[model samples]
Target: MKIFYPLIFSIFLFCYEISGQYYPSQEWERKSASSLNMSQPLLDSAINIASQNENAVNRDLRIAIIEAFSREPYFEILGETKERGGPAGLIIKDGYIVGEWGDIKHVDMTFSVAKSYLSTVAGLALDKKLIHNIDDKVYEYVWDGTFDGSHNKKITWDHLLTQSSDWSGQQFGLYDWADRSPREGEIDDWRARKLYEPGTHYKYNDVRVNVLAYSLLQVWRKPLPQVLKEKIMDPIGASTTWRWLGYHNSYVNVDGIKVQSVSGGGHFGGGIFINTLDHARFGLLFLRNGKWVEKQLISKDWVKSVQKSSKAKSDYGYLWWNNSQGSWEGVSKEVYYAAGFGGNYIIIDEANDLVIVSRWIDNSKIDDVVRLVQNSIK
Candidate 1:
């Protein structure tokens, strides 16, 4: 990919400062593929590959949730679930829409892509000094019994962000070990296993992820949805249609107000229900290093940190999936994305000045989509 070509993109906003590019308002500007110096045929192929290769996740998300976690002990959807639409996506080059297909305005469950949004909130907290440091023990801020245990006491904000907490506990009636138990082990044996030192093990458990959400709620002293909306979403000109939801039982009293603690992903159910356009806006924010026009909404340091690999998992970062360890073969190692169930994604290619959002595509086609999109540039 000619990552530098976007700075000199022939389409629009040319000859401006490197950081100065289009910022969408209610209506986003569009440019044809050929005008952007991209092969329209190749761009069309990328969109067709995404729109045609629909994922197998059921439209009735309740059933989809059930089938997904069927192996978990007594797994149940504790939050609201919505039926999803067909494949939809957007391809933005130089902050302008270059290629799009399917129902881009249709709101759908983005699943774990919400985790990356959660990471943004954490970065905001750090920027505001609410979180003094990333490595600070979470127990310091959340003095409650949540992180009281010996094992969980060592868990820092970084650990939770990277899914390396190995925090053992229950939240909103969901058990940590029960969420994704080793299929080979018996239920009794799974719980009896030794806990890995905090930040040493990488396990993808939604219950643990929600624990991070709950901890952040304590630190922010308000609803995380509020933090996200004010600090990230609104500044980027995102629509009001998006919703960040949690389980029915996830509400907690904070500052004399009942605020629902949001989830990092829709594991049991209830995450971000957002349209493809909004997702594109979010990716564009990261592509611009958390800036919106003249304002640096979030620190570039934090933005760069999210792309770095975590010690526990080389392909993982602060709730963001990184390509640093080459998780996707032949794809740029600089690319990082938020991937979710049912093939949802918000892919950020900063080096190329691109943001791509796709929903309900086949999981296996993402690499090809990236390759084709990158190859489209001249």
Candidate 2:
């Protein structure tokens, strides 16, 4: 028995060594572009391009904030927003930063990218058995009026994660129809529009996402941020500067204590406000299949499930963007990313063991940046 134990320990060490060290520390190691078989000049070019094309939205963040308000019920929800942010990006190859540009430490509103984190919290809840199955109706766990209706009761956790729930109701003082409603329709018409069965149609609605967050809070019986920090971030060595914010009205009673349900985007202004390096660490977590060093912070099966394309949306998987069309040419079709408004992205390329975090870049230029990175590889 003693001999068998020693042999197993040696094999474990061998596997760990060959697989490379996971960066389970606040500081990320840096590697030269040439060391990773990448062209340093091309990498520099990629960084420069990203810096120049900060964001297609607006160079002035205040103007962007005003525009965000104008898009309410048309392109987004009317929630809280901060008028602070600038261009920043980081490139990680084999868990090391090869190149970076702009203010890598600036905390900015990550827009819809918060949805990915929200989805991950769902995964954690599932992993801990707080919820039995993704297929189970959310109404079963959340006995609130949020899922009281027939259509809403049909909404499952999978439906919410996939943005196909068509969940009807107001949450956190935001009406369902007031979140990214069709621009062509009148407010009342859009509000009274036909409801689709859960998981049958796709709609990027923050109200529904907030509903998911609130439900998760009920199940967790604590703040979602606390759950994330305790279960994932701290274990992965993420910094404390990061914060998940929700609207002032987003509080709800859970287990006799008031818990605030966080937003999934900055659409209304309250979402994840974090730095570029923290975003990179989160991306690396997913890239490594939810493992941080020796601990599987999130289950491997959950990670795989989040990347699987939804039936309702080919290019979307549990809030993450999938490259179903293989639009990047040389990049693997398995490549998926967490994208947000104003070009914030945490791209995970499991094929290359890479995680790229780009903040406040031109949303339209994401593909170009990605392509540039791919071309740098020899």
Candidate 3:
């Protein structure tokens, strides 16, 4: 019976892989709130809720980063950042826009939301057999000094995806120790901290994330932005204005050609700078199980994998945030999201066929806004 079930599941997945793709038009289809079986008054209330509460950190994003690091301006360290934009959002129900607010066309730095995009890139690599398995030791592919030590050598692709790698190294001129260091630790204590066994400790460190990016660049032998554009973005009809950027110093020699390795977020500087419409488009691709207009942009299996919680953090998936705790009232625990700094979220609720892209919203009010949208459905 077990053998029979395994074959059945494999056949089901194979069928999904070959199914025809679905893609959105250049302009998202718009429908009246009531036409979508949503209450107009309740939909208006939800939009109002988003518009009323702006992100508390919107006054100066640069100052927030500076304060976190207790250092000089980020421009001096990480280089130029795309200008941060004001609150913007889109509510897509069954692939059509039912609600939208703020400047949907404005492009801004999306911060760590790019990590999910990076995760998708890794997924593509996995599908192509460039990586045999997520559990494979990264050192096997990246023979450079990045994973030479005993501790780092134990790190696998899974650890890096789950933010549990504890990879001890520097990349793109940023030391792993210096990123998001504990506020109470002494300088030496923070710098020489004990390395937790890889996959045991989860720390959100951009240096390690950038190292993962650089490692993937070595595996891909080309610029990541180009790969993303060709494989995922262009097929899904993403805007040209959206850019996945890397630090100024992140370029490295790959096969005698210098290729830039992009950052996972805008912590230091340079992540994905995109508009809300493009964000919605990306979110819809996942909502549709990675299929886009007669082609599978990313494997359905990869989409399923990203939603599964990691052992190190139940609330986090592969660069995506999970709602396992159901903190958001009326939202399903099955809902997962790609979240970035400054309240950027691409919340996907497959059960409801909904995609909510919220930018620059107050973090505390996100749940309420989501609940409001859920309540509108009648």
- lDDT values, one for every candidate: 0.89, 0.84, 0.84
lDDT by residue for model 2 (1-378), tens: 787998997775664434665463456778899999999888888888888886757655546756765655543334555655678899999888898988888887888999999999999999999999999999899886879977898999999999999998877667888776656547778888889988989998878888888889888889999999998888877888999989787777777887778998877778998899989989988988888777799999999998899989988989898887787665678889999888889999887777889988877777778878878889
TM-score of 3: 0.91
Best by lDDT: 1
Per-residue CA lDDT of model 1 for 1-378, tens digit only, reads: 688787656544442224468777678989998888999888999998998999998999989989888778878888889998999999999999999999999899989999999999889999999999999999999987988888989999999999998999888888899988978458788889899998888999889889999989998998888889988888888999999999899899998999999988888899999999999999988998888777899999999999998999999999999788776777889999999999999999887888999999898998899889998999
Can you list the residue pairs that collide in candidate 1?
none
Candidate order by lDDT, decreasing, is 1, 3, 2
lDDT per residue as tens, model 3, 290-359 = 9875577899999999999999988887889989977776778999999888889999999877899999
Off by over 4 Å in 3: 1-22, 71-76
lDDT for residue 242 in candidate 1, whole number 0-100: 95
Candidate with best TM-score? 1
What value does the lDDT take at residue 186 in candidate 3? 69
Model 2, position 118, has a per-residue lDDT of: 96
Worst 10 residues of 3 by lDDT: 68-77
Error of 1 at 83 (Å): 0.7
